[model samples]
Target chain A: MILWNIWLTQDYFEKQNTILTYSAVISKAYQKEEVISYEKWSECQNYYTNPENLDFLYSIPVTLAILALREFSDDISRRTET
Target chain B: MSIETIAKAIGSILQDTYSRNYGLSKGFNLMEKEIALSSYHLLMRYADNDEDKNEIIATMIHMLSAPFSDHEIDKITQYVREIFFKQYPDEAKRVWLALIKYSNYKKANPSFYRYQDEDSLNKAEENEEKFVQQISSDKNLTLDLSEISLEKSEAYLLARAFVITPYDTDDKDFSNFLNHILPIVIGDLTKVEDYSYNRTRESRKFHHESISDIEQYLANLFLEANFENSKSIFTTLVNSLSGNAQRQRFGRDDLFEFVSTTLDYFVLKLYDNGNLKIDP
Candidate 1:
């Protein structure tokens, strides 16, 4: 099932989407050192297919971005549900 | 946390994901919870308890989802503010600042640290620097992309291909050599599907061309070498070609680099085994 999720992710990214795959997520985890740098993580996530070069991509991030497209708020009082 | 703990969490999430799949007929059943859960699986490895694990994972997923949104960033800030801030103010402050830094960094440059390993990236940079140095010193230095006359380059063959021309000096037939040997070396590969470097246009082209070039170069090399069991290796590469061809879609420059690097190492093996047949 983990492998299946990974395959789906590879397929999704290969098709040029942002949805994270399991393998990519693991690869991202491999990148996180002392800090959780999403910038570094995003840099590693590939949204295309390239079998000869797999090192440039990783396997994790958000999928809710597909749905929640809201304006960025400034005040903490104007932000969040949970 | 222990690997067993993380594995257990993964198992639980997989079960949740599995149960979610019952009603869906065509599309996948993955939702925010599942995606968030999977993303946190990495952070879950750091969790000492389920409570902290769940909260941290939720915060990470939320941050990942709306990385740029002040609200998402605040949600994580809130997580730090209410929970850790009260318990460990210093640590909480550090984390909160780190979170903000991370969010800003993502917004500013969503693409950094794309390298597979620092070592390789460093080596590539060093090679580039040396290439510039050499080109500066001897502007006449052109790459030798011919068949490489294996006997003449026996020293280079014995060492790494980099010892001769480390840069993307396209003059050497190293790429072609890699292309030739990969079909034979394909057997030792455990997971061909891991190749997912497809980031940019040039990288994708390299990935696709690398695989396609390998097949083409190997066929040419086989015909040229005309070894005793050339037919067997030739047949094998052709048989294995379909998988790589399919993998070409997932190819990237690093994947091509990987193939090239693996070829550099494996060619030595082939030579020692007398399979490379370094004649003429």
Candidate 2:
């Protein structure tokens, strides 16, 4: 059930606008360290993809900025209440 | 012997030699002789073994003898022998072997002594002094864009961002945050996403763009999202690129003021709209 919810969340985030979406966050991670090799980026993506790293996810400045947006904040509030 | 002992012996020998025979007691010549003697003494004392010590001693003697007449050379050699030979018999043998071997080598390869001579050394010293004066005066001391290209500027921006992060922030979490945010900041300001298709091939490209107003652009992005510490972060980002501007000595502060002016207006705007949240 938890895995299903996580997958649903990931899918939902992926479907949003690319500029402030999960893809943007991941692209930012890959682009942050210009010297990071493709393999290193893939490894980091896998690491963050895990549900256990949610705190790691929430810690990002961009994540916080995105969450501050009314769309994301309202969506999160609605999800949490349900 | 310890370095101090060796240094003292060398100093005394040079002083006595200068007084008795060399007559190098005034002006640039005297200063050059003193510097050379000190440098040779340092090399001889720290040499790996007897062979290296002999080579260094030979080089020193050959270079020092270049301006001296045969009569003066004989007098200085006799003076050196009386003080140094008696105190160090083994060192005397090494010195003798070095003089014989390297004097022949010096004669055979005269071109090799070009920089080892006084004129070249004096010229080098003059250049170094000029460089020091240039930096101290901060005149024509601005770093060129060629020296720090766009890629390097981006790297410095990221490094500066990491440096200005709060000291108390958790390292892993902050690192993760930086890794996730810096790219977005860089990309938004510097590049735009574009896709191209050629029959069966489709490719994505990031088209580069130059920002005319970094502060204004950042303000729009940060103020729209209501970023915490946006002013401070934007200031650092602007400051990081200040070196790219010519005459950076005063230009940096001017650029910083511009960033402050541009960002502070947004801060005021957000406050007026009752959107500013002071999260304690």
My TM-score estimates for the predictions, one after another, are: 0.19, 0.20
TM-score of model number 1 = 0.19
lDDT of 2 by residue, B72-124 (tens): 43334433334444444344434433333332333333332257788887776
Candidates' C-alpha lDDT = 0.35, 0.38
Query: Model 2, stretches more than 4 Å misplaced?
Result: A1-82, B1-64, B69-74, B111-280
Which portions of model 1 show Cα errors greater than 4 Å?
A1-82, B1-127, B131-180, B183-185, B188-206, B222-232, B235-280
**Considering summed lDDT, which 10 consecutive residues are worst modelled in model 2 chain B?**
B199-208
Q: lDDT by residue for model 1 over B1-280, one digit each (tens)?
A: 1223233434444444335434433122222234433333334333456455435533432232232323233333333333444444333333332332232323333332555888877876565434333322332333343423222222111112211111122322333444443442353232343345443321212123223333333433443444543445455544664555545455342434444543454455456457756531
- Report the TM-score of the second chain of model 1 against its true counterpart: 0.22
Best-fitting candidate, measured by TM-score? 2
Q: Which candidate ranks first by DockQ, i.e. highest?
A: 1
